[model samples]
Target: MERLVDYLAPRGPLDWVLKTALFIAAINGLNLTVEFAMNGALSMSLLAHVQTTSMVAFPFTLFALSIIRHQHRLQGQLKHLATTDMLTGLPNRRELLRRLGEERRSFGAFILLDIDHFKRINDRHGHAVGDTCLVRCAAHLSGSVGPGDVVARYGGEEFAVLARTRDPAALEALTTRLCEPFTCTVAVEGLTVPMTLSAGVVRADADLGYAELLRDADAALYHAKDTGRNRAVFAPGRPAA
Candidate 1:
C-alpha cells in the first residue's frame, strides 16, 4: 500500500504526468479485458470510452500531483530542520554523528574546537551580539576547510571538523587556518569581540575505536584549555602522522 502511494506521488511534473498516463492506460486495458470476456468482441466504442475516462480523470490527477509535490517539499524542509543548527546553518550534532559513523573507517582525522571565552562574550555583550559572532565565526570556519571535509556545529559554542586527508602537515595547516580568522577582533553590531579557538585533533590511523578517538580528542581539547587557550593540540595517543 505504501509503495503504491509512493509510486503515485511523483516528485516532478513530468514524472507525475507519465505515471498518471500509465495508470489510465492500465485502467482502460482492464475495461477492454472485461468487455471482451462478456461480449467476445472488441468495438470502436471502447476508444471513445477510454478517451472520455482519461479526460475526466485529468484534472483530478493534476490536483493530486500538486498535493503530493507539496508534501514532498514539506518533508524535505522538516528533515533539514531536524539535521541543521538554526543559528549557524551548520549540521547539528545528530547529523555530524551520523556522518561520522559512515566515514569512521575512511576519515583521516577528527577535530573538535570551541570558543575560548564564549561565556564571557555572552555575559559582557548580551546574547544578541554573541549570536552574531557565532554566525560569523561559523562562516569563517566553513571557508577554511576543503570541499570534501565536513564541518558541523557540535553544540553550544563548539564545532567539529571531519578532515579528509591523512597528511599530518595538512592537518596542522588546517588547524592554523581554522584559528587564523579569529586572530583579529570581530565587529558585531558595533561591538568588538575578541575570539580565539582551542582545538583537539585525533588521527584515525592508530586503529582506535570511534568512541575512544572522540574521548582522546576531547581530552586533548581540555589539555589545550588547561595549558592556555587559542592553540590546537593533537591527542598524545595518536601519532602526528
Candidate 2:
C-alpha cells in the first residue's frame, strides 16, 4: 500500500495471481497426462518434456514471487524514509502537508511552533546538543498532544500540530506546556538545557484552503514571536492571552 505503482498489474493481486496460475498450470498438466495415458498416446518423450517444463515453470514462478516481495518491501522502506523525520521519527513536512490537503473537512486547529533562540543554543552547546534538543522536543510534543493529534517536525527548530478540538483552553494549555521551561529539554554535556517555544495557531474552517490556513498560522506564530516569544497567537483575530 506504500505505492500505487504495482509492478504486476491492476494492483493487490500479485500473490493471488502467482498461486492461481501455478495451480491451474498444474491441473492442466495432470489432465493432459491422464488423457494421454487413457488414449494410449503417452510416450516417454512427451512425459520427459512435461517434466522439464514443470521444472522450469515452478522455479521461474517462485523466483518471480520472491522478486515481487523484495521489491514491495523495498518500496515500503523507501516510502517510510521519504516521509519520516529521521531524528524525531515523526512525519516530515511533506506528510503533514499531504494530510492537510487530503483532509476535506475542517480540523479544529493548525498550530505551528518554533524554538525560541534555537541558534543560540546550537552556537553555545554545539550542533549535537542542538539535535538532542530537537529530538526531546519532538518526543514531548507528540506525547503531550496525544494520539488524536498529529504532531510533526516542520523542519529545523520548528514543529507542527494538527488537531480537531474546539476548546480554546485546551489549545492554550498545550501551548503553555510547549513554551514552559524544562518541559522540552535535553542534557547537554551533563547539564540540563531547556528551550522555550513560540506558537501560531489558526482555527480551521470549511471555507479555507490548506495553504491559506497554514499561511495564517505562520503569520500568527510570528506575531507570537514579535510581541514576545513563548506564547501562542491566534491568527488575524487576537493573540491568545
TM-score of each model, paired residue for residue: 0.85, 0.77
lDDT of 2 by residue, 1-241 (tens): 4343354422347655766476448755885788688986754576675676666677666666566667777787888999999999999999999987886354678889999999988999889988898998887787678447889899999999987676778777776776676534454377577678898988875477777898888999999989988888888747776
Least lDDT summed over 10 consecutive residues: which range in candidate 2?
2-11
Report the alpha-carbon TM-score of model 2 versus the true structure: 0.77
> Lowest lDDT 10-mer window, candidate 1?
181-190
User: In model 1, where do residues sit more than 4 Å from their true spots?
Assistant: 1-13, 26-44, 181-188, 237-241
Tens digits of per-residue lDDT for model 1 on 13-42?
788769778767776788779888998986
| Separate clash counts for every candidate | 0, 0
- The residue pairs that clash in candidate 2, if any, are none
The most accurate candidate by lDDT is 1
Candidate 2, superposed: residue stretches over 4 Å from native: 1-56, 104-106, 183-188
Candidate lDDT scores, in order, read 0.82, 0.78
